[model samples]
Target: MSQFLSAIIPNEKYYEKSAFEQENQKVFQESWYYIGLTSSLAEKNDFITTDIGGKSVVIQNIKGVIKAFHNVCTHRFNKIKTERAGNGSLTCPYHGWSYNQDGIPFGIPLKKEFQGLDKESLQTLCLPEFKVDFCGKFVFVNVSNSEVSLEEFLGESAIKLKEISIMIGRKIEYHEIPNKANWKIVVENTLEGYHITNVHPTTFFKQGFTLKSEVDFEVQGQHTNMTLHLAESHKDDKKRAKFHKLLANRPFQPEGFFHQLVFPNLSIGSLFGITVYIGSIKSVSPDESVFAYELYETNLGEGELLSDAISEVVKFSSIEFTRTTLAEDKEICENVQKGMEQSNATKGVLNSSEIRIWEFQKSYMNLINK
Candidate 1:
């Protein structure tokens, strides 16, 4: 674990189109992708459409079972649905071809034009489905047909993630910000807290957050969790006691903030018992990506205006802090992207605090090279 060693991946890998294409095929397409929360499709026939490595996919809840399929029409290869989420059977807009919840084509206009095409034969035209799974209320889809289950892929991180989701109770806010940087940069920035004192001095570090020592580092399989503790000197005994009393009845009692990074693209930051921030990074191209944030809060009881107001204020402030931090990180990433795209740019070294970044880069290289 030499601190002065160079980055695992070369600078060209960050902005090269060829490297991006390889990653899309090997990493993004092969690995499981986090979709929206399960609550997003609460009813039968409810479906959500999204893209994986530029390939469209649709996930639907049919008769209590969740299923995923390629969102392309079998007739003319047209995208059947483009909406984010909806309820009803999938019908191709190109023609009147209708598909059942299971992705089987059930109806087609001009029946006489296709004399040999009946429901039985039309089964061949069914949409191609991918592997779909859930962890607590969160949904995930893997485009690859590999036998490895999402649970296995997630390993120990699965249970921790589910626990956090359950503690948060319900999702209260969701937003996605398009980023003009590579996905790896965003993920790397998240894996370590070394930048907090410098990059987030005003927002996070100024609030008494201190990164856990290396001995406290916890890494399981492809996931890593770093606990951020509040400085003892910054603790207010009276205020702390009041907050604990206020949230005593809640399901999850917060101790300190915990930041977890699931290899490749997911990052979760939980602040005491106040709020949980789940972020997903999706690559759009060699130099473009999307950073999505899902904020959740614990159940504080029903119709309590004061409690609700407190929660609202916390959520609003959290969102603002996250936005400010992201803006700062994004600027750095964009600049890095620019430097990496240049011919003379060389690889940089990682400090000991950035060990997680090194681990992530190694995992990524292993996958893409495999």
Candidate 2:
């Protein structure tokens, strides 16, 4: 790291309530958010509701096209959909107001109560919509009307992610964890390997992963990618043979594990032949954030019994390992949040190993200050 880049970011960026509000408005609301895989809403009317910044959003598939809208009912202002995901027309649980998959108001109860109202007049009552786009099978939504396309925002990271998404086939598991920490804390924790030896010693370090003396860091716009090379000992013929056998039937094989940070709050850890874990941070407040994860595995399609058995064992083991590693990160992030709240210091120093953290802080400061 350059001497000029190794400085402490202000503590207020992590724990200050006012600063959190500003970030929500300026950073998250204006940026594109990765929702999930396009296959998540494969059938018509399949919908998923999520929150961006503090605003509620409902995304659904309608006649093969994906659409997003404010989750609130236009009539009563009640949330249109409360469940996390399901397959059905969006309906307001409050008063029976219903919307089509396109978010167009199609049914409003009590026809006699609103005598003059009809479908033609109701067309103008469509739910407020957001912009939606995709990169491979992954879907992203932007709340702002900014002209920047998702591809532009993603840049080089998009190319890498698209390759990984294709290899992973489709999403197999989804999980959400609510952490008692600022969203920044969770994101910063992921952008560097400085904590792996200490924080994930048994899981990552034991597996021969380390922060190399000469780290290869690439920054494209707000996105960053860091490549981790496993120790040569871990790449011996025996283990290499086993890995190749396990992934023999898979369509795309990854060259190596990659840790990528998609600016603002998406962290991706892609382990070749193991799993692809995408952790998306959703800030609930200054001291709370929800981390949503979608885990994907390589598509094996149909195979012989022996091959299927080996694949299942590998998949199960990979999922378990990932779950344990994520739990470790979650615990550390929560503790960091508590420390920031009680500390009197204004900032903390960064080391060379944390160059990505510095990059993230700089990116964040640029956006919030803008």
Q: Give Cα-based local distance difference scores for all models.
A: 0.79, 0.79
Pairs that collide in candidate 1 are none
Q: Which residue ranges in model 2 land beyond 4 Å of their true spot? A: 1-4, 118-120, 170-172, 211-214, 248-255, 300-307
Error of model 2, residue 332, in angstroms: 1.3
lDDT by residue (197-262, candidate 2, tens digit) is 787877777777766423467888899988666666565558656766766766545445678888
Global lDDT for candidate 1?
0.79
Model 1 misplaced regions, further than 4 Å: 210-215, 237-241, 300-306, 343-345
Model 1, TM vs. native: 0.91
Cα lDDT over the full model 2: 0.79
Question: Model 1 over residues 184-219: C-alpha lDDT tens digits?
Answer: 988888877777777887887776765532224677
**lDDT for 60 (candidate 2):** 91
